[model samples]
Target: MRFKYSIPVVFVLALVIIEKENNIISKVSDKLVLKQPPMVLDSSSSLQLLLKPNQSVPSFHFHPRTSAPVFTLMKRRLEDYSSHQPRTQKPKQKHILLLATTRTGSSFVGEFFNQQGDNMFYLFEPLWHVEKMLTLEGGGTNASASAKAYRNVLQQLFLCDFSLLESFIDPPPVDHITSNLFRRWSSSSLCADSVCSPFVQGDFEKFHCKARKCGPLNLTLAAQSCRAKQHRAIKSVRVRQLDMLRPLAEDPRLDVKFIHLVRDPRAVLASRMVAFEKYKNWKEWGTRGGDVPLDDDEVMKLKGNCDNIRMSAQTGLRQPKWLRGRYLLVRYEDIARFPMRKAAEMYRFAGMPFTPQVKSWIARNTQVSPKEASGVYSLQRNSSEHVEKWRFSLPFKIAQVVQRVCRPTLKLFGYKVVNSEKMLTDRSISLIEDKVFNSL
Candidate 1:
């Protein structure tokens, strides 16, 4: 009986020993696995892994001993994932807002961008209607509200949305007769391009019947086409301050850039005086006299305009970093003097290639004698001759007042103040005369 019991105990002890040996072997195998470098999946291996059976999957993780290669694999996988992912589309359209005051050659600048052929759609003072709308809404005196509305309107206009403009269609801004004319012309052009003869006939019922199907009648086709173009630009002298457009300038959805077109105050005053004289009988004339000395009201108006110019210059110069590459300060005098060079610079700033077609347009529009260029509101001009014409034409008293009111801005823009005789004799050019001088 003792022998049998001892034999059973011996068998139990043997079983325990075998189990201990198996545990030791398993631990050694694990150590060996840790000693080897982690396996990383290359493109082919990764693809194979993707194809493999779900239950027989290799581990994506590595042994703790090879943490470095594990991280490398992680980085590689991330790169691969990014490379294989679908790319997001970027905004195709770009907007250019020409920030300028009245009589600062903004119209010429507008025409320059407009004549960029089919790829460019140019709007002349789209904000005039906004101002009128603001007045109608009784928010004219509230600068902040007016600015917000103006920016909102600009956003819609840039996106080629004209539904908001229907409200202002019936009785548009009285001061914007030119804006009305442009609307009529655009409507006529769109109708000509897309509408049938029956739609255009005097019979209102037939026109209305066809108009429902012809969507171009509701919105500007030029503007709609512009949405797909390389560039869309708008020029406005109504905007008195650059700060008012800070939101638009910094918007990422719309690639917006600003061209601050400035003119010498003395020259601007002289032009206004000349216009005042030419259109004295016109009720819409902002200035009262031309040959006669400036009345108190006229002087005050000139002073206010000069102050606005100064403010705009200061605002542009102090732009933040985001606006650094977007804001371009251009002088009317410089553009007038060197049309081709300045235009090329402008195109570069606007991210457009300067084609031979653009060069041809500049040459055709700008090749005119000073005598022939006079009394015409056109892009063609004897630019060099036009630059200093204000010096000879402006009266001495008027010059002094403009010089005094615009002294700070004159200095900022590199314009010099001189006596009447010196103004005629001195060949002092624009202070900021360099083609590539973008202080902003």
Candidate 2:
């Protein structure tokens, strides 16, 4: 008797051998859900089986030759995927850092990246924890010390290493788990099911979060989530200067892009007064109806913020060797008026695909009534209407003081100077100049 091998027999043997030799899922028998193919299939050429929803896994079939009638099933080898192939250079990952101060529309702009869907892991003020923990631990808040610590924490976080972050959390998390991630709810990637669970209550108080049951997300789990993401973005208002971030930006292991966001200095002071209780004194001073000297501690504090903002932008605009093709300057006023257009630019600058989801979010967020997004930190707003609210809120005298103190910054960024009280309050007159600030 002669031994003859049929195509089915050879195919079964091949599938078994592939399964034994490789780590990839053997598509024929694994319970993987089959997705519908784009076209009808045939055996003469390799083709995907058209599948319906809930369809069972199907065999992959092909004919070895045009003259033969034999049909065969085959499993894709582990090496078949482009990702598994040996490469001379690894693909660069997008790591974006949005540098801005409080009241510069940082939160609003951050949503552009955060809503890029599941492939993005967003960090909303991870430095908030570092700042709080350092303050409690007696770590001085001097510029050098603070910037150094911030730089270190950011570097590790981008790498998905949570240990450095865990060390900074007060009332340390147990077994690399914690519920106190600052606004942990803000990052959907962190709140995903694989990394977090419903908060439980006890002496330790099982992570009870009101907005979502998610709490006590494991640092290990968070790291896993971050690693799974193709890109990471950090939005922070605490970084006083762009130069402080040079080490992280220049690291050979990472590709980092910076979006330097700025707003008018006078508007910043006006918004800060309403949003921060610590500014009550400044509020009182504004309401006291007198000339505020440029040298007042409060005024100087505002001036310092302006100085940092201007300097950082000027540095980025210069496009230093380190920052070339990695820096962008964005004004809140421009974004407020054309939310979707500016969002596309920022996404392009970061070298990330601009997704339809972000476009939809911008459309909904920018056109809504202010009441729906009126909270001090709410991301939603009628953007065009909201930017000018500060104009009416800041008294003329206070505005004049800001103009004098933040003059250099204001002029550098092309804000129209209001020469009189009437010019300051007239909403009919546009205060923002139609000048473009380029980072290239």
Candidate 3:
């Protein structure tokens, strides 16, 4: 009786082992089945049933002994499904850099690009903060390092990265009467279409912004708007050297193009003097503090700036054919005299179509009368009238000084020198009133 009982126990143990081996084989078959078509789901079908689009896991009957393996296979199939899904491709954006100096009508040119449409994004003086940072870090005097830093900042900006511009986004307190108007103006102009739009339009119900304060929301919107554009442009007066931007111009990823905006140095000088005087009067009234007083040093600095502008233009025009193809020299005078014609050419150079909307914008902005409130500094002005104002505004002595200093620059840009003494005694001088001269 003891021997018979032991034999039954041995037979039972052998059957259990065989069952375990079958379960292992079933799991292997399930995995192999994944490789076959989903239609092949007969009894011989391997693990691939999990991949069928409409099939439910609960609909399939698994052997009770192999339930754990079925659950494991289901989990893996879900993961594989997720991993095999398609991904979206990012849209390619064009990058444009406008090379110019201060008071060269760069603002107008920048705005032209910005106003092209909702699809175009423009940045104004993005390098201002970089210059400030360099000064604070004692790298301002290091030309090579400063240029490299500027290029890096520009690269990040072209890629729609605004993380680096956070500190510079702070607007002045509106209550601070001594804040520089020009600084406020620059910040306001730069953020107008983007960060400050809702606030500026008094759309409090839509967006809330504290008086003269810009928060993260502003930066985010600006970055998003920039990233959404098919074309991106940045205008800077700090980058006076074309060579400083050679690497960016040649960058394969950027599809970069350069617009070298040249202005008559004499006109530039005259404008600077007039602006300096106005700034001085503003400072004297204590409406602003930390203003740079016009002194011999300031004069020398202005002269140096003019020289650099001239040199950059001259150098760019003289570049070799391969490099020259990437650059387009646009004269402030020509743009002022014939905005629509030049604008079309500029758009073509930028590889964009000159649409009707752009034409309408050009007409609206460039057709203002000479007596308009913002005729002096506003982007909206009678282009011809505004361009010729310098001729009447600069005094004979000042004109002579500017002419002598900027002779080569003026010649390079094809600007004819006016006879200062003759002009001073002419009827043109009679047209400008004492009030206009004082205003200048």
Candidate 4:
């Protein structure tokens, strides 16, 4: 009976204290809702301090000196302020790798992403620096070591980190600074005012940006520009194997996409003969119009180049778990025939917007004068016409040799083999079979 009496006393005390708090609150204004706090039982004693809810809705009792209406308004404001939505974070940056062999229309395809304006950060042949430096150090000639080095540099570049690249820069960048980035003018991102200001009034003429026209490339500024971009893309003809990029693809920080570009072996051989001064021997070989030795260095080189491209294509087409929804194979012939359509497809694969600027650039560059398309390394061309132009220039004997050595590559990429010299040089007949290498 005494314990029950003590319980009532405790409840009364709790109620009195709550009532006093309410009185102070009432003096301010009458509109504020009075919410009862939870009733709690004391473990040490038989005392129960209880608070009964006035209604289901949340009610607050503010202090004295504030009117009920003022308190209510303040309470509403507090509630409204406290219930604000969480901030939305930006999506992970898209890291794109454009992989191809030399003279495969990679420059033209790379420009598709490079011309995406400020939102994109594109680098052209950044691996060239690595290969150059490593070769000087005698490590580049070793294929495995060189591929690993290229991968490391590429990984850093995609992260917008230039620290590793600085190590490979010619004359070596002092304190993360360098002016001699390989093909510096090739990447619009590097040429932008953000990275390097133009020394000359017209830094960019037609499609080419002359390096002399621009100031030294500040790596710090380049990095800042890279991070500011929503996407990053690097074009490389150096790294040979598609499987070599597994680590980069599986990286948690990057959303990576690999775009592999391939051209017909006959076309590649023909173009290499014209473009590279080093291919003079090949030119001599073709002009001789004799049987090409299968064991000869030049013939072996042709076989190796074609075989590597074929193998890489095969690997990408397999679409292993690490590379799923990330690998795309594009035939240079298909891109040449359909520039806008193929470019849009590539941009779509990389999850980038295909803007009108790129569209306009494609239109202007792809249908230039013969003079504009003359450079050995020129991206400007009459694309559709150039696809079959190889047939006219490439000797039938040389074409046969390419067919013999690169038969697997030809069949895989949908290039038809010719029976005789007449068939090899005939532009009237189509050699490219209808094929789709790039699909969602």
Q: What is the lDDT of residue 428 in candidate 1?
A: 65
Question: lDDT of candidate 3?
Answer: 0.62
Question: lDDT value for candidate 2?
Answer: 0.77
TM-score of 4: 0.77
Q: In model 1, what lDDT does residue 194 have?
A: 38
Q: For model 4, how many clashes? A: 6
> TM-scores for all candidates?
0.67, 0.77, 0.62, 0.77
| Candidate 3, number of clashes | 3
Off by over 4 Å in 1: 1-91, 132-145, 172-223, 277-297, 425-440
Please count the clashing residue pairs in each candidate, in the order shown: 1, 1, 3, 6
Preferred candidate (lDDT higher): 2 or 3: 2
Off by over 4 Å in 3: 1-92, 136-142, 167-218, 277-296, 373-376, 424-440
Misplaced by over 4 Å in model 2 are 1-91, 136-140, 201-211
Candidate 1 lDDT:
0.61
- Tens digits of per-residue lDDT, candidate 4, 250-273, equal 989889999999889888878889
